[model samples]
Target: MTLTTPEAPAGLPAPTTPGRGRGRSRRAGRADTRLPRARARRPLLFWPVTAAVTAFVLAFVAPFLVIVTNAFKTSADYRNNGPLSWPEEWNWDILADVWERVGFTQKLVNSVQISLGVVLIAVVLALFNAYALGIGRVRWRNAFLVFFLAVNVLPQEGMVYPVYYVFREVGLYDTKLGYTLLIGVVYSAFGTYLLTSVFAGFPRELLEAAALDGASRWTTLWRIVLPMSWPTLSVMCVFFFVWSWNEFLMPLVLLISGENQTVPLGLSVLQGQYSSDPTAMSAAALLGVVPMIAFFLVFQRTLTRGISAGAVK
Candidate 1:
């Protein structure tokens, strides 16, 4: 005997399987749960972080705004309207006047020479010192490193008088080359310490492989280590350059001649015993900082990579 199964009601849809219904319900429920969580998280997490970062950036940029805006204003406008106010009239001539009257053109050349010299000398010395301490297996390396750290921590004021006397006796005082040497020696201590860490973290396997291939220590350092360490070296160069450029105390003491003065010294000449030109000084300052800003922009990526690489080990 054959039996017929019951059919669905006319005009009604066929029923879905239990598994299909369950899956649809589960998916719908999950979507419903996720949508609310995402909506809730938006206000609680993302917006606040964005606002904080924006505020921090604005705060950081506020000073540059003051410097740039006031740089174009006249001294009267600066004094009457205050530092934060917009300029009544732009005195674009102040920049040219600063360049000529303050002898900034000559001072800039002096600064470039001194700063480049310091960076060159410091980097070369630091590289040799770091390689000796880190890769050459030199005895008493820790003691040497400690001595450098000690020198780095010593106050510049403590050594200034003695340095002045010595430079004068050696007939090196008030000379740009003398100041360059002084800054190079002073900054090399920190550079040595920084590069030592980078070198010590060098891959042991590579050094061993180079040794196996009969590479001498100098060859390994020059070919293998230096090529790999260019980022850190570039960072050191930027640091030393910036420091030498901005250094006022050493330049003030070591360089006395108007012709030999750097940008900072030239800017000081803008001030008088009683009165000062705020607008021209601002222009000079803006000019003075441009090279540093340009340098950082050019090397920013390398600087970041160097810092991150050094931090890794």
Candidate 2:
């Protein structure tokens, strides 16, 4: 009887070598170690991203700070100090003066009334139009949709003169009602297109089911369509409201009198008419932004919700 041991081949380690197992163990350890280092490097790359966001935020907030500080100073103080510096004295006198001079209280009420009217009209028209184009049996719907989108591409100034002439011919100029109507007309096309897209994304089966349950078209729309489309409607309403409130150019040409003018138009007059007083102009500008800020604070949650819903399936 004989016993035999296997021979080691060339370019191969001997089976009895003491260091072979340790070498293999070390190789495995190195492979395992490389992964965590790669993972650790991921977070290190985020610093530039965070820095850019911080810079963007500062760029936006700085102008607001300058406006607020300038509003609290005397015209002389503004001349003496830098735009970013603190006011020597907390002078609210400019605010009072601007309010009285510009008739801010009356203008605020006018702006609110006009903007509300615009929102109501714009939302109603846009919803009906969207429903017709998106859900109802309509001929040339795609062509009309393209038309509406094309309307958004043109500058508003292109139509300003024609609109002004039409208003004048109809004797609707210089009235709050006229301004509201104009706002609705200008905003409807874009609104209709946006809302129609939203409507198209909704499940048609829900509407059909309601119809099978003996619901009328209008009933189904109010109950099923409108309810599910709340997020889109909310976003549109907020957008229209803010834009109408802040609209300056159209109102300036259309509403000639200070009494009928919106807040933005009145603020422009304040800036121009008080060119000698920087403090007063700054105070008026600050006052003008207060309503917008208040609105954002109140509806910011709805805004975020709407955006999230619109983006997700």
Candidate 3:
């Protein structure tokens, strides 16, 4: 007996076999089921997280609001009106007065110079150190990293006096160069700790390829590693700059003269023994903060990408 499969109707595709059709239907059902579940959970997940983030932002912004509102008020008005209240009268002259009285321009110059110097020296040293520890086949690499980390945790107060005495003996005390070097050294440990992980995770294949091309380690680092790692490097620079800019203890102890003191030190000078002007103080504080806020805004995109890159694999 002869038998033949039936033909599909004109212009219609052949029907799938029962087993294959069942399998496809099952997969389609699964996809359909999963989509609704995900869609259903999205709002449930989104609103709570949104509410939480909003609360966190408000908490952070509340203090800045207080400072800004009070900064534009007269001291008497600020005192009478309470921190939460709006200023009765806007006194814009307070900023100019505070700026001149605190010698903010000179201190700003000092801060800018010191912060740039610290960032330059610290980032260069950290890049070299991280390259050695992370990429090179060095002995006791883990131990060296641990040592760098330990240096970070060592309290500044513990070493500050000894460092002060040493700087005094070496005639580096109360000098811009001295203060810059001191802060650079203190912050380098943190930079090393941060960059080492980034360097260590770099692809060994690239390093090997560079070696095969007869590129020296320094050449490979500058040409290959550094170009690719700039996001991380830039983030580190921003952090180190901010830290050095705001550093109080080292600059306070090291930079004694009015000419040498940084913005923080200058702000302290503004709060004189006989004068208690909250409005002026607030203006000075706001002035000191403005540059940092501007810096962060300028580098925010790079900073965000760098931080996220570091956080991920």
Candidate 4:
């Protein structure tokens, strides 16, 4: 052991000179250098995006805050208090008054029935129309699409009188079926446009493959096209539902009887008849907002995905 002359401490190689080790380290560090300054600064790009997002959220949330706050307010509070002010306490009686005055349950049921009917008719017709426009070799395709686009651009005011006259002539005036049909026809053009784009983007190979396997056109559409197009369909349904539910002008023109009035019309009636009750009006408006909010919440993901897909491809 003593003669082991420090036999370079068992398995260890002789250590390099300090300068040499440092030189090697410097070279290795250079070789393993990270990305350039511009590349490294890429993460800073999100700053503007973050700012934009912050601004957007504030803008949208501000009005919603006002609506929700006013719903809890007394008439005096709404008139005298600041919009930004928070509620001092919960107010239950205001909601109760609104519910009774507006016949909230009956109006809500009518709205549901009308909106559901519109959606059913519009979506069914839209599905067929979209398939024809997108996949079928129907004549005057561009003209047809352009016609719908033109319809969308027209002021609703212009259609109202014409529609009123037509419904009057057909003895369909003051009927739920009339309003349903009117809203469906007016709104269906846009739905067809949306669905057409989605259907057009579908890979033709899937359709062809199904055809080769002896699948009829209807069968293929039922099994493949509709299933794959759910995101777009959901977006359309939610959109149409919101539109139909919120429609005030059409319902006003079409529905005359107390038994047939939709929620929006009924809310308007309450507002006029109960001008003395600010609490009631605010409450009725708040109640009216619930269905639209629920519709968005339920289908928001599908709407987002459908929009994203549409944008990308």
Q: Which residue ranges in model 1 land beyond 4 Å of their true spot? A: 1-28, 311-313
Q: Highest TM-score among the candidates is held by which one?
A: 1
Query: Model 4: runs farther than 4 Å from truth?
Result: 1-48, 79-84, 87-89, 273-277, 308-313
**Against the true structure, what is each candidate's TM-score?**
0.88, 0.86, 0.86, 0.82
Model 4, residue 34: distance off in Å is 5.3
Q: What residue pairs are clashing in model 2?
A: none
Q: Report how far off residue 261 is in candidate 2 (Å).
A: 0.8
Can you give the lDDT of residue 44 in candidate 2? 88
Per-residue C-alpha lDDT of model 4 across residues 1-313, encoded as one tens digit per residue: 3643344677889666569899999898876675566576876897888999999999997777677777787666666775567767668788887788778888899999989888888888889899998877489988999998998899888988998999999999999988898889878888888788777777989988999999998998899988887777777787788889989887888898878998887667655543555556667778988878887788788889977865675
lDDT of each residue in 110-184, candidate 2, tens digit only: 999988899889889888989999888489999989998987787878878998999999999899999899788
**Runs in model 2 lying further than 4 Å from the true structure:** 1-39
Write model 3 residue lDDT over 1-313, tens digit each, in one string: 8866689999999877779899999999999999999999999999999999999999998888878988899978877877678999999999999899988999999999999999999998898888888888489998999999999999989888999999999999999998888888778888888889888789989999999999998899989999988888989899999999989987888888998999988778767788777888788889988999999999999899988877776
Q: Count of backbone clashes for each model?
A: 0, 0, 0, 0
User: Cα RMSD (Å) per model?
Assistant: 3.8, 6.3, 3.6, 5.2
Q: Alpha carbon lDDT of residue 23, candidate 2?
A: 97
Instruction: Please write out the lDDT profile of model 1 over residues 143-258, one tens digit for every residue.
Output: 99999999999998998899999998999999988888888987889989988987887899999999999999899988999999988898899899898999998889989898
